[model samples]
Target: MDNSLRALGDRLRQLRARHGLTQEEFAQIAGIGYKFYQDIEGGRKKEIWLSTVERLAAAYGLRAWQLLMPNMPEGSKVARKVASSRVHRR
Candidate 1:
């Protein structure tokens, strides 16, 4: 896999974990097939379309560019809310 793709996969895994979601749950929320998402997150996929990126970002209530950033953007309001809710649930 390309290094960039691996980096993106790592970020995706981290974000999904932070939101307290399983791969299946995140795939369902992103409206993508479980196997396809698994491939993406596992860095086994050869290519990723812009639309897929958009869909994944939408599921996180973020923009595609934000998702692609080298660092996790601090602009995710939804992430903050979800994180706080997870804390409360615990």
Candidate 2:
């Protein structure tokens, strides 16, 4: 996979968690198939469409270009909340 795509996948995972949504929920909000979203987040997709990116950005209340930024949010409070919840669940 391209490094940029990998980075985008990482950003998507972090953003979805920070928004307090499971992958399935986020996929629904983006109006995409759950498995397709999984592929995107897993970096298995070869490419992503602009429309898809726009939908994802809208779901996160952000602009598409923001989502494409090389430096995006990471290790924030909301992300920590999601991380802790996963630990508790296990």
Candidate 3:
């Protein structure tokens, strides 16, 4: 698996635990299939779709970029770059 995907899985697992939710519960909340959610958390799914990212973010009450780049602070260089690119696309 890619290192980035592994990190994302780790972060997602941490978030799920922090929220006191089981994988099944998290999957249900995210409106994703339980087995697919497990694959993501286990880093078996390397390439996540943008819609899935959005879903995960909504499930955690976070922005899509937050899930894409875990631990990135708001107003940081990377965040600004992503935001600007998103704006340019619109």
Candidate 4:
């Protein structure tokens, strides 16, 4: 798995916890199955869907870039790379 993906998933777990959301609650909000969310948070980033990422960002009150880039600034170099990757993937 990509290190960027690993970091993103880790940050997502922390963000979910900070919002007082359980895996069940987060899964509901993200519109993904509970087991799917569990798989992601359990350190396996193999099944994420972009639409679901959008849902998660909305639930956290953060933009997709924020969730994807974690500690990076919105328009910083790292954010640009992540955004670029996302853009090109489609």
Candidate number achieving the greatest TM-score relative to the actual structure: 1
Error of 2 at 74 (Å): 9.9
Listed per candidate, the RMSD to the true structure in angstroms reads 8.5, 9.2, 9.3, 8.7
The model with the greatest lDDT is: 1
lDDT of 3 by residue, 1-90 (tens): 999878878877878777688887777777777788899899998687777776776677677788677573243111111111221121
Ten-residue region with minimum lDDT total, candidate 3: 76-85
Model 2, 1-90: lDDT tens digits are: 999788888999988767788987777666667788899899998887787776676677667788888888433222111111111121
Shift of residue 60 alpha carbon in model 2, Å: 0.5
Cα misplacement distance, residue 54 of candidate 4 (Å): 1.5
Instruction: Compute each candidate's TM-score over C-alphas.
Output: 0.80, 0.77, 0.74, 0.67
- Each prediction's total of clashing residue pairs, residues at least 3 apart in sequence or on different chains, is 0, 0, 0, 0
Candidate 4 global TM-score: 0.67
lDDT of 4 by residue, 1-90 (tens): 767667767877777666677887776665556776777777675656676576656666667777787474232111111121232121
lDDT against true structure, model 1: 0.74
Report lDDT (Cα) of residue 79, candidate 1: 34
Give Cα distance to truth, residue 59, candidate 2, Å. Answer: 0.7
What candidate 3 gets wrong by more than 4 Å, as runs, is 70-90
